[model samples]
Target: MTLLIETRELAVAAADSIVQPTSIRVRAGVPFTILGETGSGKTLLAQAIAGTLPDGLVARGEILIAGRPVQDLAVHERRALWGREIAILPQEPWLALDPTARSIDQVAEVYEVVRRRPADGARDDAVEAMRSLRLEGAGRKLPSELSGGMAQRVALAASRAGGARIMLADEPTKGLDAALRDGAIDLLREAMGSEGGLLTITHDISVPRRLGGEVAIMLAGRIIEQGPVEDVLQRPRHDYTRRLVAADPANWIRRIVPERFGDPVIEARGLAKFRGGRLLFSGLSLTIARGEIVGVVGPSGSGKSSLGDLVLGLIRPDAGSVRRDPRIAPLRFQKLYQDPPAAFAPQLTIRRALADLVARHRLDATRISDLMRRLRLSDGLLDRPPGAISGGELQRFALLRVLLLKPAFLFADEPTSRLDLITQQEMIELIVESAREEGCAVLLVSHDRDLIDKTADRVLALEGSWMDRDAVA
Candidate 1:
């Protein structure tokens, strides 16, 4: 089989080297994955291949597509080639999508640009592609109206519609639930069969295993090991790969000692929520006693986030009521939103944002510094705006902001979904420990069953306004 894409000692650098000299190949009709932890330069390599590296980043070595040297091509030539032969599924779909345009139109535009098809024909193809990824009727909706998972599918639909020969997907399933993730994997597999080759970069180890591809383990910008998926992941040769495999959530043991709970700090009774004239949920009831950690688990778009908003009084319930202890002040209730970047002002520096929160809460500088240290954040990070930092860093900062308030009740909604396994474990441990120390009742809304099992004292299975007790740990 002919090689679809090949990198020969390809290196990328910005001020300092980001990706070390690396060589890799993707054959036609095959899938390959690059696995690495956060800030390990996997994304840089992907960007280098796509010729989309940000300004100030320099590329060295050679990148070939269908036996053509991309480096030798003019800017316009490279752009034309990219439109026809390559498509990128970005790490953050929302960033890639235009908020003003309808999703379907955005996807159809790709087909029109790359395939030069008629508008009507491109529209039909775009809709068909969306349907293949289970995104029916999502075409008319603007990106702002779609959920994180829905937006991801839209991005995938656009990539598929582009009819590119090689696909580069970066953290394709970062925010999706298990079912959606599986659907995405299937779509990518289908694309591989049609598109000739697929290269995926992700921190999620399960992705490579599920895609059944060649795996390349990246550490500190270097590809330290490469082989079949099972051999590389299961029987890794490098210490870094072995550590990553071991750091899988499945290997982590829960050591949370059960503590007795007091009276309810926050309670929701027969709660109901509606969106877009559809009932998201109704007749849901739950309680978070003081010092208790209650885990809420459900499928995507099943109102887990809605329930969190209801508890936090961010959204009014259509029915029933949410009550918090009268003694607990309103400021004592904090929410850690799922999209950390959206929670802050984009133009404001992290230091300015944290300072405002600190001043509002009358918190001391010492306490803020201590919290930053605990979260493994550096002092320099405070100088950058929210958009300038990584998702994981932004998430940690968001958590730090909420924790500074020393809330009596904390609502954490998929707080660590963007973090790597090791960081996820660390954040979970810190949340549990801090919440316990402060006697703060927590409502942890997540789709990760292992995470819930490890952190929650009790679990509630949510199914469209109904809550069933899954277990009491």
Candidate 2:
């Protein structure tokens, strides 16, 4: 197999250096993954290869695509060669997608740009790409109209449409449910047949294993260990790698056992929701009690997030009622949305947003600092706008904004989905501790079966608007 992408002593620096000098090679037909915690510079490395580094970031060292040096190429020159030789699926789909245009149009644009096809041909290719990704009706919807997971699929569709020999996917499955994730992995594997290869940067430990390829464990800004997936994941050589592997929910020693139930804090009865005149869910009902965690699990587009919105009164139910305790203030029921980037004010810096929240709530600086520490967010991030930070960091910051409120009832929609294994555990622990110590009732919506099994006192499964109680063993 021919080497597709080679990085020799590649380093990316911003206001201050982030990724240290790192060397790696990706070969055709092989899948290579770089796994790391949030802010480990995995995305930076991938962006360096794609020549898409942000404005302030500078790349040093050498990058070669198909044995041709690209580090010296002009931006437009690199972009001109991108689709034919390389393609990048960014971690945040919103960044890659045009918010005003329909999803299908954006995907069609990729076909036109990369393949230089006619308009009708591009549209046909776009539809085919989306269909392959199980995004049947997504083409007509604008980026804002699609869910986080759906937008992610659209990005994948665009990347696939480009027909690049080498694909660079950054957290491609960031917001997908288990079923969708499996399908995505299959698509990625199929894309990396004998003709091409894939280099993915993700915190998802499961991805590298599923792709059946080499895995590199990145810590801080460097790859500390690299080898075959099974060897690296099963018998990690570095302490950081071991810690990361152990942090997987499968390896965790502690579990959250449901304690005795308390009085109901929030209740939903005969809830029904519709989007674009299509029924999302109907006749769904659940109750969350004080100091209880109720988990909702289902496939993508199954209305799990809509249920959270209903409980939090973010959206009105069409045919049902959400009853909140009179004692609970409006702010006492908060929601941590799945799409963290969309949840914040794009114009506001993280520092400004947090400061406003703190001022309004009269929260103490020390308390906020401690919570940020627990969430593994750096002080430097506070200065950056929500768009500037990675999705995981934004997710943590979103949670922090709500945690400061000390809400009596919390609706967390895939709260930890964007996070890496270690941070997922930390976030889970934090949520559980909040329920135990602060008597905060939580509606935990996620597709992670292990997480639901471990943290939820009761589980509810959603299928086409129908809700069924899941027996917890």
Best by lDDT: 2
Q: Residue 445 of model 2: what lDDT?
A: 89
How well is each residue in 1-473 modelled by candidate 2, as lDDT tens digits? 79988999999997677999999999888899999998889998998999998888999999999899999999899988777788888888887888899988888998998799999999888877887777766667888877778889999988888898899999999878887898998899898898797999999988998998898999889999998999999998899898888887766554556658678998889998987566778887888899998899887777888888888878899999989999878888899988787789999999999888888878775677899999988898999998788888899988888888898999999999888899999999899888888999999988788778878888998874321121100
| Candidate 2 TM-score over all chains jointly | 0.95
TM-scores, one per candidate: 0.92, 0.95
Candidate 2 residue runs with Cα over 4 Å from true position:
253-256, 465-473
Against the correct fold, how does model 1 do in TM-score?
Answer: 0.92
Instruction: Give me the displacement of residue 108 in model 1, in angstroms.
Output: 2.8
